[model samples]
Structure formats: C-alpha cells, structure tokens
Target: MALSHSLIQLLISLRRQKFIGAGEPIRMLEFGEQNWFYDVVPAELLILIDEFQDVPAERRQALKAELQQILDTKPPTEPFDICKVFYKLVFNYEDYTAVDLHGTPQALSLDLNEPLGLPPHSWDVVTNIGTTEHVFNQYQAFKSLHELTKPGGVIMHSLPNQGCFDHGFFNYHPTFFYDLAEANRYEIVALVYADCSKHPHQLKQLGSQADYVRLAVSHQLSAYSGIFCVYRTPTDAQAFKVPRQGYYDNRLPPELQQAWQNLAR
Candidate 1:
C-alpha cells in the first residue's frame, strides 16, 4: 500500500529475475493500501482483498474500460490479464478477517500496541511499505511481519530516511538493514535509496548500497528520500528476535567500527 509507480516497477523487474519465483502463488500481506500493485502485478496468482478504492466513484467504468483496453492491446508474449486482476483478501483489526468480493473496505488496523493474532508463517510475502514508522512499537510490528512470513518468504520495507518530518515516528538508514541481515541471518537481495521529492518521471534510478558515500552525504544534507530493502527469511522457520542496533551487532568489522566511532583528531 502507498506504493510509488517506480516501486511497483521495481518489484516487477525484480520478479522477472525470479528473485521470489513467479509460477507459485504469492501470498502477500500489505501493511497498508496496495492499489497500484493491482495494475501491474500478474493477478492470476495474486489473491488479496483490495480494500483501497483507487479509482473515483464516477470514474470506475472509465478505469475498467482502460484496463480492458490495455489487456486487449498487450503483446501476445506478455503474461496475465492486464485489466482483470482483483483484490482478494481483507484484513481487519478486531482479531478477525473480513473480505468483500466487491472490493469494499473492511475493518483493519496496523496498531503495534495490539496483537495481530494471525497464524504464523501465513504469508509468502510481507510488505511494510511505509507503515512501520507509524506503529509505536517498531520492533513488535516487525516481529509480527516475521511471524507472518513463511520460511523462504520475502519481507520488503520502504521507509523514510530524510527530510520528512511529521511523516512518522522514525526515519531509517541503510545500515539498519545491513545490521539486520547479520543479526537475523536474513539474505538481503536488494537495498537502495530513492529520492522522493521529485516527480516520478523526474526521479533518478535508485542508488544501491554501493552508493553509500553519496547517500550518506546527501541524506546528511537533508535530501528527501526513502530506503527500500528486501530480505528473505531462512528456508526453515526461526524465532523472531529483535535486531540489535548496527554498532552493537557483535559481528562488526573494522570499517563498520570506524564508521560508528568518532575519530579523535
């Protein structure tokens, strides 16, 4: 939910590489609205009760027609019905799940203070998509995501990094995931920063962790941005442990140690 068009495209490109595998069903749990994803992802294997009303009330027919038009015009080699995908599951806050075939809203909550009460290993994919910062208990919310994901499942997060006050309770850094990967033994597939202040058309390509120096200086300079990262849970189920802060992970090497220590010049 709350995905940028660029973010959707990123997922598509990554999926094409078989990063998460395509043929099998993808059980995705979104922490918020995923309206844009419906337009791009292959709907044949996607089942989620789309609770967000992306199109305006009066424009639904037009949007439907547009979807149909795209499907009809798509090249023969392309897979999936471009216009026919629908939302399948609805998440509710009251310790229950309710779904509307008509794609209407259901009771939902992302509160970290309360238990989600969902079964463990229930999802093949868990996406935070800018929700964790709003949850008062960041670690607890993340733990829920971890529990909800099946072994070998993927967890994705996109969070604010700079120049967005009043946006959420916390803004994250790339090192957070670097440290997280080491602590939890998660395999990191992608980690990058996107500048959000610009228009989608104007936004530059995302910078990977390899661009750490530029990212660090720009973020330090108050550039508007976010961090997007994907992590794969182990093939076997593991306990969800709160990750230690980066500098304290105990697996720290010299460069990382220097990064954290202020030099006594």
Candidate 2:
C-alpha cells in the first residue's frame, strides 16, 4: 500500500500536463495501506527499497544516494499536499477520517469487488497505485472506480504490464483500457508502456489501441514495465455500462444469431 516514487513522478507530470488543476483538492480512495508521501518518496530513492523491495541494504542505499543527487537538480513542483503525492509522511494514520476534506487529500477505503458505498460521482481523482492486480473481480473493481469518479474527473492507475511474474492476480495488457475506453467513450490523456529508469524514467506515448496491439509483439523490453493510464469521464455521464469485446460485438455473427436471439429473448 506504500506509494512508490514512480507514482509520484507520474502525478507531478500529470499536474504539469494540466490534467489536474493547481491546488485542486483531490479525494482519494485507498484500496489498501497508505502512508504519507515524504516517508516513502524520500529525497533519496533507495530508502524506499525496504518498504517494498527485497534488495541488499548497501546496494539500494548507494543507488538511491546517487539517484537522489540527480533528482535534486530538478525536483517536481509541489503544489498539492504530500498526502496527495509521494513520500511516506509522518502524520497519524488514524486521523485520515477525522472529517471530510474541503480542500485537501482525503483518504478513504474502497473494496474493489463490492459497491463503493460512497456518493456517486464524488471523487475528483481516483488512483489505484498498487491494488487492482490483487483484486479477483476486475470488472467490479473498475466499475466501482468509475462510479466513484465525478464526471469530468480523471482516474489513473499504475499497473504491472510485463516482466513481473507471480506479483499479483493479473498483469494487465493495454487492451483492457483500450477497449474499455472505446466502450465507455472516454478521453485518454496518456496510456503508455512505462519503465523504472531513474535519472529519467520514461513513458512511451500511446497513439491508438489498434496500433499499440500491432506493435506489442515487436517491442518487448526486459525490465518490469507498468501501464500508466489517465481517463477523463465525460460530463453529463451516468453510470458506466461495460462494453463487450469488439470481436464478439461484430454483427453478432450470422452463425450465432440463434444463440444471440435466445439470449436476447
């Protein structure tokens, strides 16, 4: 449940990209454990290895110190609260729900598989830093995210895509969001193959879903790549209706009309 430095980089970039407005308080639903930012994202990156990774102390510490020095040359613009970004903070976790935020990062719990039990269209931004891969009911989890998002809001997810094994229930393929975006008529801000290259972690810009599919076979990389997606819900939208796969949606096929008719009836 710890927030990763990569997640911090993305959000800061998102804000700079103007996807998120300056000083706009965002409501966050944490699917699991969440600590404040500074504690996790430290000025030094290696300090975070202990919270999640199993690396040698000397190796990580040394790597991060060098990495940290490089990062300090160009720190991200810090507008929103650290709770809204990175760093394992030093605040009392129990006070998370002391009251609803009027202009701050509000953390709440969300069960990806069940009804969010929250106000519909309530959150300005919903982030699944590292939880969706663990939830078995993927549809419900995504649906709950959509339901909780205010129209015109954005939902971002940092999901494992390749090179990582046995890390969770599933490693997402880009098609999931590509198809979902098409079905729900979403406006994609950015969807790309992201890598953890410090000093300059990069994200490949995705043009279209079809093009992405055609190129996937040719562009396999060695490191663990994450799928970073930003989807903007349309204003005046209602509940999300999951769309069927286009291959299956193609004319229902004359060969399957009888089955389709029976199901329709």
Clash total of candidate 1? 5
lDDT (tens digit, per residue) of candidate 2 on 1-265: 4455566666656645545644434554444444334534444334433433333466446555555554566334232233422321211112122111122344444456676676778766666666788888988888887887778877777788775678889887666787787777788888866765432446677776544444443454435777888898888667677867554667334434443344322
lDDT, each prediction: 0.58, 0.58
**Steric overlap count per candidate:** 5, 12
For residue 62, give model 1's deviation from the true position in Å. 17
Q: In candidate 2, residue 6 scores what lDDT?
A: 60
List TM-scores for all candidates, in order: 0.69, 0.64
Off by over 4 Å in 1: 37-66, 69-104, 201-214, 217-222, 262-265
